[model samples]
Target: MSVLVFAEAINNKYKKSSLEVVNYGAKLASSQGSNVIVLTNASADAAAELGKYGAQKVLNFESDSLHDNKMLSQIISDVANSHNADTVILSDNSKGKSLAGRIAIKLDAAAVSSATTLPNLEDGFVVQKSLFSGKAIGHYQMKASKKVITVAGNSIGLEEMGQPVAAEAFDASAYNATVEMVETKRVEGTVPLPEAELVVSAGRGMKGPENWGIIEDLAKTLGATTACSRPVADTGWRPHHEHVGQTGIAIKPNLYIAIGISGAIQHLAGVNHSKTIVVINKDPEAPFFKAADYGIVADLFDVVPRLTEALQKFKAS
Candidate 1:
C-alpha cells in the first residue's frame, strides 16, 4: 500500500508543482498508514526538504536524459517496481503527461490524469476530475492492481508535518542518450507564471503594446506575475511565454485578474481552474464576465491606473 511520488526537479530546483504532488502523495499515504517516498534529481539538501511535507524518504537519480521521456519513464517504472508501490503520483503538467503513459505501460498499470481529488479507496479507488473546461465534474474508478495518477496543479495545499531527512542515491540506467553541446534559451521573469499565486493578465482590448505599462504597474504593485491572452501574444504585444490559453501555457493561480481580455473557451480551458477570477472589461457583454467572481465593466485605461494607485496606497498604509 506504499505510495511513490515522482516530482521532477528542473534547473536544480523543485518547482511549486513538484512540491504540490509531493504534498498530495503524502496525504494519500498518511491516510493508509503508509510512508511517502519521493523520486527526484534534486540536490540532497533540496531533496531532503520533501521530508517536511511528510515524505519519509527520497530516491535521488541524476541523468542528462531528464528531458528524454522514455528514459525518465523507465527509471521511474523501475524504481516503483522495486519498491512494490501500489500507487504512483505525479503532476498533470506537460512533463508528467509525457512520462505517465510510458510508465504505466511498463508497469501494466492504469493511468489517470488531471485528478482534482485524492483517490478514494472507500469507493473502489475513485478520483474526481473536471470535464469540459471545468463545466462538469467526473469521478473515475481505477480498477487495476497498480495505479498511476497525474494530479492537477494547485488542487491541494502544501503542509509541513515532519522533520527533514537526507536523500538516498538511486542507481538506474535503463536508457541514456549521447548528445553534443547545444545552446539553451530561457524566458526570464520575476515570477514563474505557472506557479504564481497571483496573476495580472490583459488581452487585445489593451489596444497596443504601449498601454502595457498599467498592467505591469498593477502586477508589480500586487507582486503578481503578468500574463496575456493569445491574440495579444500573436500580435507581438507580449512575449509568447506570457500568454495563457489552450495554445499557450496553462496556469492555476490563486487570484487571476484579466483586464481587457475577452474570454474565449480556448483561454478558459487554461485558467478555469484558478481559485478566483476577476475580469475588467469595458463591454458589459464580454464573455469573461460570466466566469469572473468579480467583474468590472469599465474602460481598462481608466480603471487599471486607479486600481494600481489604490493598491499602492493600501500597501503604504
Candidate 2:
C-alpha cells in the first residue's frame, strides 16, 4: 500500500505547512516500504517541488472548480480509490482540515486531525494528536479500510530527500456541487495567523484602543500580523479578529512578540507553539517572563517606540 499526500499550493509554490505534511508522509511511506505520492490541484509545474520532500511521484490536477471543497472532495476520493492508498495525509490548515473531513466521509475512512507526530506503524497505525487546546495528547488508530490524517503546522521539519521529480497530470470527473464561487472579499493587511512566520501581539497592558497604533506600527515594520489577548477584545481595545487566546485564534508563528501582556494561561494556550517568544511588560513579576525566550521589564510606552525604531533601523540595514 502506498501513501498519498495532498500538497497545498498557492501562487504556484507549495505552502510551508504542506511541506511539513509531506515530510511526515515520506517517513510513514518509508516505514511501510511503499512509495509516497504528492497530489496538487494546480498544474504539473506546481507539483514539481514535491520531490524535495521525498515524493516519488507528483499528481497534478488542473481545474478551477477544484477550489470548491465539495468538488475537490470528489477528485481526492477518485485518486484514493484508484491507488487504494492505505493512508492519505494533508496539512492541518483550515482548508486541509475541511478537505480531510469531507474526504473521510466520502471514502468511509477513519480520520484524525491536528496530528502532531507520525503514527506507530507497528501493530496498528496509532496516531498522536493534541487535544484540549494542546493541554492533552490523544492516541488513536484507524480501524477502517483507509486512514486519513492531517499534520499539525510547525510540528515537523521538511528535509530534501532527493532531486526534483517529474510530475504527471491526472484527470478526474468533476462533481456538480451546488456551492458556487462568488466575489471574494479579501481583507487588506490581515495575514492569517496560522500561516504567519512572525507575529506581533498586544494585550490589555496597552490600556486603550488609541494606543494600539504603536503595536500596529511595529507589526507593519516587521511584516508581521497583529494579535491581541482576550481582554483587548473584551475591553474594545481591538476587534475580535485580532484576539489570540483560548477563546480566539491559536497560532504557531516562528516568532511571537507579546507587548504589555501578563501571560495568562488562556493566552499561553493559544501561542504556546511559537518557536520563540518575546515578552515586554512593566511588571517585573509578570508571569509571561517565565515562558519568554526574551523579556524586557519596562513600560510599553517607553519600550514600544524604541523597539519600533530599532526594528526600522534593522530593516534599513
Candidate 3:
C-alpha cells in the first residue's frame, strides 16, 4: 500500500515543517517499498515541489471551504480510503494535530503524535516518539488497517531525492463535511517562530516589558521572531504568544538566541531542537551554558546594545 502525507501550507506556500514531514514520510515509504503521495488543500503549485522530496504523486484538493478542520479531516479521510493507504503522515503543527486527531477518530486508525522518527519496516512498523518533555523516547506500533502519525517539527531534515515530478489531481467531494470559515485572524510579523530561520528570545532577565524594545530590535536586525520564557509571560512582561517553554510553543528554528534565561529543564525541552543556541546571561554558572553553543557572561543591557551595534557594523561592512 502507498503512504500518504497530508502537507500543510499557508498562502499556497508549503511550510518548512511540512517539507520535513514529507522527507520523513518519503523515507518511510521507500523503506516499505511503497509509493509516496503528498496531498495539499491549496490550489497553488505545491505539487511541483513534492517530487524533489521523493513524492511520487501529489494530490491537490482545491477548495476554500476545505480550510476548516472539520472539512479538511473529511477530505483526508476520503483520500486515505481511496488509496487504501497503509500509513498517513502529518507534521506536528497545530493544524496537523487537530486534523490528524479527527481523521484518526473517523478512520479508527492507530494514532501516534509527536513522532521523532519513521517507523521501522522490519519491526512491524513501529514509530518512535518523545515523551516526558523529551526525557524519553517511546516506540509504538499500529495494529489497525491504517496508521496515522504526526511528525515532530525539525526532527528530520529534508533532502532532494530527485527532480520535480508531475502530480495528478484528486477529487474528494463525496467525503466533504459541513463547515464554515467565517473569519481568520492573521498575525503580522516578519516570520512565524516555527517557520523562522532565526529566533531571538528574552526571559525574566529583561526586567520588564518596557525593556523588550532591545530584544525586538535585535530580532528585527536578524530578521528573527521574538520568544520568551514562561516566567516572562506569567509575570505579564510579555504576551502568551511570545512564550516558549514546556507550557508554551515548541520551536525548532535554525538559530535560537535566548537572553537572561536560566535555561530550566522545561524551557530547554521546548527549544532543544534548535540548530544553534546562543545564551546571554550574567550568571556564568547558569545551567543554560551547558546547552548553549555560545554563552556570554555579562549584563544583558550592556551586551545587547554592543552586540546589536557590532552586528550592524558587520552588516554594513
Candidate 4:
C-alpha cells in the first residue's frame, strides 16, 4: 500500500507533532515494506530535514493562500492520488481532524482520529484509540482498503535515520482561499503545549499571576512546559492558550504535574489522557487527588522550591 504523510508547517517551522506523525507513518510504511512520502509547506531546506525522520521524498506546497481547510484538503488529496497513496497519515490536532473528513470523502477512505497505536495488519487493519475521554481503549478495524489516520501527539517517539532527501515543489499558488486569514497572532511560550511531553500546569490556587514564579521555576528546572487551568486564564493570570480544560486545549502529555489545581471535571476532560499525573494540592479533597497517580497534600510553595532544588542538584551531579 502506498503511504503518504503530511507534515504541516507553521511560521516556516515544523512542530514536534508533525515529526511524530511522520515517524508513525514511516513505521507503518516499513511494516508494509514501503517508505514515507512527506508533504509540507516549510522551506525546501526545512522540508528536506524530514528525511532524517524516514521521509524518503518530500513534496513542498508553496501557497500562501491555503487558509481554507477545504482548499488544503483538496490539495492533499490530489497529492495522495498522484502518488497512489492508499493510506494517508495526519497529526491528531484540530486542523488535521477537520481536514480528515474532507480528505476521506475525496478519497473514499475510512478516517480515524487520535489513534494511539499503529495498525495491526495481521488481523486486517486494526488500530487502537482512546475512547470516552481516555477512560477506555478502543480497538477498531478499518474495513475500507484505503484509510486516513491521525496519530495522537507524543504517542510515537521520533526516530532519526539520516538520509539525503530530494524535494519537489507542488504548485498550488492559483488556488483561491474561501476563508481568508487577515492576521495571525501566536501566543509566545517556552514550548508548544500540545506537543509537550512533560507539562507543569497550575490553577487559581497559585493565588495570582505573581505567584506563578514557583510554577515556572519548577517547570524550567524540569525542562517541562507550563500550562494553567481555565479559571486562571479567565482571571487574566495566564494566557488562554495555556488553559487546558473542556473549553480549552486538550493535551495528553506523558507526565502531567498539576499544581494548585482543584481538578474540576471540565479540567480533567482535557488532561485525563496523560500517562501519569502528579497533583500537588494542599487540600486533601481537591478532587484532583482521585485521578492523580501521585498526590502530595502539601502547600505548593513549600514543595515546589524543594522539588526544583532537588532536581537542580540531581542534574548537576
Q: C-alpha displacement of 214 in model 3, angstroms?
A: 2.1
Root-mean-square deviation of candidate 1: 2.0
Query: Model 3 segments beyond 4 Å from truth?
Result: 64-67, 174-176, 314-317
- TM-score (C-alpha) between model 1 and the true structure: 0.93
| Alpha-carbon lDDT of model 2 | 0.85
Best by lDDT: 4
Candidate 3 deviation (Cα RMSD)? 2.2
Q: For candidate 3, lDDT tens digit of each residue in 28-84?
A: 888878888888766637667777887778888665444578877877777888887
Q: Provide TM-scores for the models.
A: 0.93, 0.90, 0.91, 0.90
Point out where model 1 deviates above 4 Å.
63-65, 173-175, 178-183
**Alpha-carbon local distance difference test for all models:** 0.86, 0.85, 0.83, 0.88
Off by over 4 Å in 2: 64-67, 188-190, 312-317
Q: Which scores better on lDDT, 1 or 4? A: 4
lDDT of 1 by residue, 1-317 (tens): 68999988875677778888989999999887887889988777778888887788898876433666877787788788888888889888878988889888888898899899988879788999888767789889888999899998888877777888889988765457543336555567677887789999999999999999999999999999999999999989999989998889878899999999989999998898899999999999999899999999998999999999999999999
What RMSD does each model have against the real structure?
2.0, 2.2, 2.2, 2.2
List candidate 4 stretches off by more than 4 Å.
Answer: 208-210, 234-237
Give the candidate number with the greatest TM-score: 1
lDDT of 4 by residue, 30-139 (tens): 99998679989877877888988889889997543445889899888989988989999998887889889899999999988999999999989999998876668889
Question: Which is superior by lDDT, 2 or 4?
Answer: 4
lDDT of 2 by residue, 205-230 (tens): 88888888998899999999988999
